[model samples]
Target: MASEGGFFSAVWETIKTIFWALIIAGVFRTVFYQPFWIPSGSMKDTLLIGDFLFVNKMAYGYSYASCPSIRLQRFGIDVDAQDICFFLDGDNTRLFGDEPERGDVVVFRHPSTGQDYIKRLVGLPGETVQMIDGVLHINGEPVQLEDGGQFVETYERQGPEGRPPRCENGAVGPGADCIKSRQIETLPGGSSHSILNIGDYRGADDTGVFNVPEGHYFMMGDNRDNSLDSRFPASAGGVGYVPFENLIGRADRIMFSSAGRSMLFFWTWRSDRYFKAIE
Candidate 1:
């Protein structure tokens, strides 16, 4: 009888330890950082597909979107941020809120789908943003763009989606050098970053000026031609001006990066990108 009691006590102790560990991890994720995987090439060259980073939740303070959303399909767990912190929804306000700066790489909740998206903040509230002939214009003035040569990659299926990259040279067969024109774009206030251009006068190359609404921000991707960003309306399957409340966090660095389909493949890791700072 004593042996039976001892076995139950050990089991209970193990369960208690696991429960506390989970609680601590949950608190850390909610209050500090959240892990994010780059699943698309929209922000390529700056953030690549298969790159893993931690979003700093404290950067812009706490909101409902700061809550962790777990969606493991294999486990049948589908919890949304709203499910955990629904009481914080509806109001477009945040606790200890701080306005995001221009040229910041930010992750926010999609206004329509509630999914997460990462893009560079280009237009602040009440600023006019336009893309005139593939050049970024702010408040009717064109920002500076200097030639930065070409960005090349192998013309093969990339990432888990097996999508091929579009090339400026166009229609290169597999195993050839796929290239896109690269430029150093300088935003207002001296923030500079690399932007890619595949072709001239393509879709979204020239758009009407967008006057960003108050309490909202305009975002774009470094891979200009491929990104479905503020240039397209949310109703048209694109990210429109995102509200301040939907801001999840800031991506400050790349914790890990893999070039292959699965991150578990250690041979596919990009050793140089480990612990790399996000520009």
Candidate 2:
């Protein structure tokens, strides 16, 4: 009888251990290294609609559950892992571990509806940002375009590529006449990256200057002609000016990439992009 009781106790302890382990793992995944799927072409030529990315929560800090009004979690938790965050909401709910810098690729909450948006930070707080003929001028110096990148040719018909189809910035359809081959112009910055301009005379090209308000940032998409960024007004669904509190964190790297149609669980994954650093 004693032996039997001991055996049952051991089994119960083992089961409890397994249950707690699963619970801990789930919390770790939910708080750190959450996956995000690209939903639009606004960040095209850089981030495609099918791209799967891992956002680093520890790269910034803990994200609090919005309470009464979504309160941020109190600090001092174990830093064993990080959460993948898409955007930082401005309710003072979450605080970043570090501040953003010029030329950093960032993901933030859209000031309009709190949707996540990723863009290149061009103008910092209290600076003048303007687009002159598709060229970005920060403060007083122009962000000149230097040619070094090769032509990125994609045979996938824009929509039939199995990516989400949207007319947001001029997407027509698969095999559509509007589909034109364009060059990926590499822009030199504090850190250089590529930009796509489909033909010239991009609408927001000739725009009035935007004096970045204090505690706000001026962001633009690498796909200049297509992205509705600070250049567009708030009424038109553009991410006008993001506040410092709205930043989630810096885009550290690309954890994975897949053809628009490939689900993340497939066996034949594009393992090459795994662990590749994001420019």
- Writing each residue's lDDT as its tens digit, candidate 2 over 1-279 gives 999999999999999999999778656644565456666566666666556776665554544321012224585443211222334433444554555667777777667665667888878788898777767777766775665443343434332245433232365545443332334333334566777665454568778889998878898987776688888766787889887666655677776766545554456346667766767
lDDT of 1 by residue, 1-279 (tens): 999999999999999999999999999998999999998888978998889999999999999999988999999999999999999998888999999999999999999889999999999999999988889999999999999999998998888898989899989999999999999999998888898888853469988889999989999999998898888888987899999999999999999998999877779999899999998
The C-alpha RMSD of each candidate to the native structure, in angstroms, is: 1.2, 7.3
TM-score of 1: 0.97
What lDDT does candidate 2 reach at residue 232? Answer: 74
Clashing residue pairs for model 1: none
Candidate 2 ranges with C-alpha deviation above 4 Å = 1-32, 61-96, 155-189, 200-202, 265-268
Off by over 4 Å in 1: 200-202
All candidates: TM-score:
0.97, 0.69
